[model samples]
Target: MPVPADQAHPLTADVAIVGGGIIGLATAWRLTRAGLSAIVIDPSPGSGASLSAAGMIAPVSEMSYQHGRLFALMRDSAAEYPTFVAALEADAQTDVGYRETETLVCAADPADRQMLADLQHYQQAAGGEVEALTSRAARRLEPALSPSLSGAFHSAGDHQVNPRRITAALQTVLPAIIRRTAVELIETESSSGTAVTGVRLDDGRTITAPVTVLATGMTPTRAPLPDDVPLPLRPIRGEVLRTRLPSGLPPLLEHTIRGIVTGRPIYLVPRADGEIVIGATSREDNREGPSVEGVSQLLRDAQRLVPGIGECELTEVTARARPGTHDDAPYLGTVGTAGRGPISGLIVANGFYRHGILLTPLASRLAAQLVLRELDPPTVPESTDHPATADTDHHHLQTMNPRRIAHPAAENQPQGGRP
Candidate 1:
């Protein structure tokens, strides 16, 4: 709900997060858990790219040759998911629909099989536990799979979560949320330099805080920031479909199916509630709405993998944009000036194209630490026993620096980014 305008003119908190998607809400939740007051501002919370995601935490299946840092980040985030969801559910008293099901990567034809083979070799070399499976062996594990599959691989480490459930859970535990658009950032000049005090909402209200976080996924919310603060982000739109199986029919799939059919990649994620999510068509034409051609292509490719999909009811079609960068990696750090180190109270946590859901737990924790200026912590092993140390966080932030426009491997890759 929108905060009533007459109630207050200037809201104050320890941190003001601009954008109420998974990143923003989860960051606020983390801040509150750390004994800090934080408020989230957005026009509609949880209705952006987070809602359109299939929520696959598939670090292995989605691995790319050029994105080694991203792969490590994804792997680490997925490992922390159990602890994150447990804490969130305990606080919210609701399930976030997290599933630990394995994923099956399939190939439609001979050419697709060759491509799958190449990916398997790379996955093995990168320390990903993947097994190349024969078509018969793959069908045995997933009986509903089409017998026409030429090749497949088993990724037992891959899993998924319900993005909507996650956002709802975070919303329940957060302290404050103003349902309004943040139109601009409020800056204050001090002896040190210019620092972000808070944000100016569209309703003529202001939110004042020492720290401000920009987690606005794919929304161009960075327009309010200074021109020198680098945020080279672009929108890559995707279309997804939802369907329900017939009442009498059994579940269509036991595991998530990710496949390539004639060079077009697609995935079908099955839920316990008899719902299957089929997607997605990645494009850059800037069509903000669902396209007929994209829908047709998804259904066709999904049917090629699971023929039973044709019998399901077409429940819904959705289109949303995922924030893309030149290297297809996220921009997660403080806003830096040309000569200055970092702005006093400005942090950026955006450009998470396809891995937003997978990266939520770590991203939120890192953002909260940045807000409290608690970047340094005692050194500890990589486990749930203790939070990540400054060494780990700094390494991640450096890899995702907003000012670094080009990646070392970006120009060498044929796609020029993550495929």
Candidate 2:
């Protein structure tokens, strides 16, 4: 329970996390365990884009994440899931629904078949683990799959977790998660330059801290940076549906199904509780809720690859706007991370796009690592255009830096006439 502004005293912490989503809360948890006082500011946490996540930890399927450092970051994060979830569950005292099931990427037609093969080729080329299966082989693994589908690729190590449960568990351990939105970042002058001092909440309550993290996804309601820097945060709306398995339908799928209809990916995640989540439709139009066409398309595509879906009961249709950067990569470094480093006080860990759920562990780790100054931050990748020669931790950091998108030229130019 958080104290209301009227009754609350001036609170402070070692670090102030400005979003209660998985990344922010998880980072708070780690900081608390490290003996650092932390507070999470979000009116309603875990109810953002996380609500619509399919929760598939498939590095193979998300090969490049629009193709960049996100690929290695996702792969590394997926590798960390087993141990990370185990520890998180132990601490949170709740079952986060971390099931280690394989993923099957199914196709619908000749073009889709070639798409599957091409994905396999890319995955293999990227040194990811994937196996090609004929249509019969795929059905053998997941009999509920349509018999007439073209082909499929299986990633044996991929798995799924319930994002809601994960967020719930995180909240359990992070009781101090403030139920108010942060309205601004307090900054102070430093030898290195401008550094974050704390955050001011919407209720006019202020919490001073040495460090502040901006984990607010999609809509960065208030930007802490100076007028010079360009955050360029855009919203990419997505829609997903949840269904309960009906009794008389084909047996619930045991493997995660990732189907490619035309070019887009349709993920069907199975839960231990007779729930199958069918998602998602990616659209550039930034909207708040699910549209009729978006939800209809998901059901239509899902049923095409797994006909049994038609028998499932529609339990939910969720929609949210994901945060996308101009570079199409996530921003995971300090406001000054990309060559602007002396801005000491702020760390940004948002703009994860569609990979937010999969990137939680790494993002949390990064937040703690950055605040502690435990290690020298990784090199900032020159540009998102080139593929990383190595998948080192530094490579991941360099690629996801928020400063990458803060265009220097655009920073100084006044916007049209608006000051």
Candidate 3:
């Protein structure tokens, strides 16, 4: 039995993960599967930035210029997703809404078409599997698309999974979770050095562990850390909307529709149950709720790509902030010194930004390897086809090192801003 939140009893585990978003929960799941006891600490799981995400696993359509390392990590994660979701579903006895449907990148105007042509060229040069398509071919795949589209392209490898279902499955399979907020880190100092021993909850209970993973997203209530550990995380708010087609109607789209309408990007992700997820507008503000302007712009841009979007009923409007980093890449490595020496027992997995859902598999697997000190973890049954490549790329890990922005000597490293 679990101890009550009001009780002052302390718990022990192999790993104590802060934050219960998909990333946190999935990492915990990975650790538990590796024969280590782990616990997730959160006030409410799956109610943060992960809740509002459109869950696009399209590394091709989502690619940008000069983010080669990040793109490689994304592609590896997308490849491993099938194995990840299959094992999770079998273990939890629930579907995670994984779909292999292709993605269509549409251009709604002449300017948008030109921009897409350039992006496609960049994507092709980067070894991405994308094919140019005429507007007629795109409409044949997704008839709901507006006929006024100037051009389109096919990203056959890009796919998606429902974030809500994935989070719920992780919650089900993970054996331990503390339903409380982590207020602070419990550090222990010894002759060796200062190491994080565990975490202190808001209810005054401490969960002791040898390793503590800080997978906290963009929540304002995150625990305070020491001055030396520089996270440099910022919040990038996004607005997303969910809509349902009227009864007796088919899904408005088969493949996900990612489009640039009047130079602004929008996407429509249609679910099997006739629900289409549309979004989003990126803003660098501190607003806590959906804004009128953001919603109006999303609706307008989305309707321009798929004319049928205007007839759907809006079900939910979500506004949440994603944790972004200086280089737009996730901070995956452990916090360390100038020589990349890791601080004992402290591992960070944050600043995933917009790719949180898509990056979960690779992030979770890598975190588990770090915690267990395993160099060659066995691939899950279905993941054999796509071996774990990103975790082994030394250069990629260096670029994603959390200390890059913190260390004075490492400050000269190249920085890539958000696209």
Candidate 4:
């Protein structure tokens, strides 16, 4: 389905996005609605992390994560999500399956119960709201829950949305999305030195724009950046499976059921369709496809959470490497610059890790704001610690600036600075 070079016409826009995943498409849509011309250069849109994500918009669930600033961003994004989704639905004229239901965190055994209690205390200490419930109380809410539960809590702030539907909705509004791979990035001379001008497609068509966003996840069709900087984006392979419930099957999972089996996190998210998404193995490997052992383990862990899933039909198993950074934080600013980049029109918006689906609203908002020069990059602090430990504020882009090198040592740094 590749477009022939002659058939593809050259175009121009105010903002040109390199990748057409949710991050790129959503940003393009936001810019276009803001009265600026926007175009996305990607062949298959929203088929990346957006498609694999189980859209759990729960900042509350991730309070205990190592990345504190990411938690802040998630919480803030979640707070404004209802309004964002409402406006997006009105504009796109399609339901993205934005469910505002509470997420039930349950325990599987007595030891797990203690862990839940400890987590509750930790959340409470962090000034977060969560209602503790006994096993009986938890089952009263989700009766289909495991009968061997020890304890549970209700995070009222947590919710779920269908990521697939959201991706489709984003694609609906960004009609100028180019279904072609970018063969090269068009960088031009500016006072800031080397800023991206536009993109050159594989078919030899050139689409010029003042700004070009490097939303291209993990793999880039061409090198859009300089060789001096390091992106440090690696493929953290994740295997996710979706199962279809049999006809006349009762509602088994009312809300998103997340549990900590031992130390690993397992989740079973219900979709609007009869399919429930039971994923994912967080493997630190460069493997390409789903492994037999990985898929089996996912099924085992999910069945341990809900035994009824054993009867569900396995609909799909997708294995993809999410763009992961050394610090487990995203790089979000002008590449190879010292924060100020009106002249350097290269904006980075990748390395989202596991929060891609949840961070869409905020990420897209930040992307648009960056394109309009309305917001500045947060400053990344000096630290020997991993990127996740960097103390930075999202509002004060000074400390969390993506332009800084994520890992100074650069273990898996891309060669020649161009991928």
Candidate 5:
């Protein structure tokens, strides 16, 4: 007899991913390819931060003075994106809108030129390629740039992707079971709290798994979990606006344009479809209604960078919350101390901040390596134990015989029984 839609059989898999964002879906897809049965749970899988992101794969452009480890990680991830997206597209038989263009950092005022110079110096010191140009030369590359533009630096390695297209493609191609429901994870034993034995749904039904990954973005911050396994994450809200330009709008911007004003960064991303994205204002923990002030602030800054934007059509406006972590880097790898006893099967792939889309490929590979324990070529930082200290010395990498956790098989098992 077929199970009714209202009362379907409890689904079981080798792994269960709690979040359906890019990281979660990527992890699930990798697990499935590795011969592990996997499932992803989320109400809106791709519409979170991934959808709202500008998708800039910029390790050099976005680098700051602090956190060298995070920079190395971003660089490694950016390097892996091209091949990763290729394989993913081949698997899905679809296009992901991967754009391989350079990014330009510009300064609209003379005082801001020093900032661009400082950034160029830092890039050179880090052994990255950057080209410094005067206002005229900068305008030569992007004619739409204002005549008063002081200076610009170009990072040729930086690129972008259409986050919406990638997300939609993944959701369509991934083989894992995807459900639209809220999942609550519960620890079977107090001592092994990090080991998620199973998850309970709203209707009082339970599904168990040997491995459960928490990629629920900020939602897990509100969930009940052991103190040791709690996520030290917060939400940073950002507002963005999109505009449609008339035909032959000068192709004013070739690569992504980022400008610094009042010590804060604002950016304008030009799409192949004549849509320019001008964004964004960062606010701390405030999800209040959108403000005209916020939109005006972005427009003021954008118009300062390129006066032509004043005439563009305001197509859309939206706001989203980005997950931030205590370490300022994403929280990856296994949670809790290993070898204490029965290890908790919970793995964290969250706290990606603004780099989620850019880092998806590397994050997916790392998560898959951790789960499968298999060594494969082109895998950066062979050892997953010391993720923060992984060597970025080599441009290419691989991993070796990872340990695999054994799980109870569901063959001839009763429905609703604990694993």
Candidate 6:
């Protein structure tokens, strides 16, 4: 059962997060652990793109030739995932679906082999460890691969995690006041039209805090932000399909597979359960609804890569809009102009695109450290507290309890099997 909104406690924290996605939850968890009171406000926590994400932590697999800084950030974040997941599981006492399997990049056509070869050359030049593999040798690693596969490359460091489980675990474990409501930031005061002071919510409630972090995914585009804040964020739509294999379907595709066709890129990821996810068509302009043409094209392309998918049971088809920036790189670090002293008390941590889950651990740590004003412990955030406000409204404020506030919505409710 879902946690009741009426029963949710209301209290001010040292920092307040605007989104409840993986990034926000991870940030809130790290902040609360550092002894600072943190609050996360979102209407639906895990129902966004994070839920529909394929959760591939591929710093090298998704590497590009131009973006060196972005690749460094992703590499740092990927390296932190193991430690992050271990600590989170130990703290939350729940499994977060962490997997350390390597990823394979395959090519089916002779023309596509050059793309893999170019990627191999690029990876080598960028000091990444990638191994060129023949089709026969590739089948040795994953037996279900198509016999007609041309060539492949192996990236041992690439990993994946279940995004839903991570989001659920963060929501369950964090000592944050999770409020299931929409919040809009109303600027109360500014200096030189650059610095922001406080924000007012939609329900006439005002929150005055020393620091506020905007982790509101693509919603920041719609927020009343300053013109100087160059968010440069937009949304990119991706369509994904999920299917289940029969009891004895020979365990097709052990590692994540990517195909570099003449057109866009396509990928397939297999879960621990029988579910195999084939995704992602990138659409530049249209993001209104799921594209039947897109889905059909992906299925056709995926089947061409691996022929055995013809017999799988189609379970679900879903679409999600990733928060993309102008250069496809997330905006991290302090907001405001160089001479403006860090925009007073606001920070922007959005525009992660499809890499939100892959980059959460490091991003959360950086956000928490910025909010807490800590100097040491370079990469991630730890729990800590800040000075509480003098005017504490006990009547209006809910009790200060993390478990009570972050409880799942469906807990303690009668469960009738999915109808």
Steric overlap count per candidate? 0, 2, 0, 12, 4, 18
Instruction: Compose the digit string of candidate 3's lDDT tens values, residues 285-323.
Output: 879899999999999999889999999999999999999
Q: What is the TM-score of each predicted model, taking all chains together?
A: 0.92, 0.89, 0.92, 0.87, 0.84, 0.83
Off by over 4 Å in 4: 1-8, 190-192, 220-223, 337-343, 374-400, 406-419
What lDDT score belongs to each candidate, Candidate 1 first? 0.82, 0.76, 0.82, 0.73, 0.69, 0.69
RMSD in Å for all candidates? 5.2, 6.4, 4.6, 7.0, 7.9, 11.8
lDDT of 2: 0.76
**Stretches of candidate 2 above 4 Å error?**
1-8, 64-68, 190-192, 247-251, 337-341, 374-391, 407-419
Compared with the true structure, model 3 gives a TM-score of 0.92
Residue 294 of candidate 5: its Cα lDDT?
84
Candidate 6 Cα errors over 4 Å, as ranges: 1-11, 177-183, 186-198, 220-222, 337-341, 374-419
- For model 2, residues 43-161, the per-residue Cα lDDT tens digits are 88898888778888877787753484457788888877877798888887789999989999988988988877876777788778888899999999999999989899889978888
What TM-score does candidate 4 reach? 0.87
In angstroms, give how far residue 314 of model 1 lies from its true place. 1.0
Worst 10 residues of 2 by lDDT: 410-419
Q: Poorest 10 consecutive residues of model 4 by lDDT?
A: 379-388
Model 3 gets an lDDT of 0.82
Give lDDT tens digits, candidate 4, residues 330-376: 76765563343223667778888787877777677767766776212
Candidate 1: list runs displaced more than 4 Å. 1-10, 220-223, 339-341, 374-389, 406-419
Residue 275, candidate 6: alpha-carbon lDDT: 77
lDDT value for candidate 6?
0.69
Residues 1-419, candidate 5: write the lDDT tens digits: 11121244566767777777888888887777666767777766786777678888888887877655566677878888888788779978888878887788888777788887887787778767888888788788888888888788888898888787787777776655445554567676665343566566656666666777777776533224455444566787788888877776566567788887656688898887777888878887555445788899999989988898988999888777778876567765554433333335666677788888878887787677555532222223333432333343212121110111111231122211122
Q: Candidates 1 and 4: which is better by TM-score?
A: 1
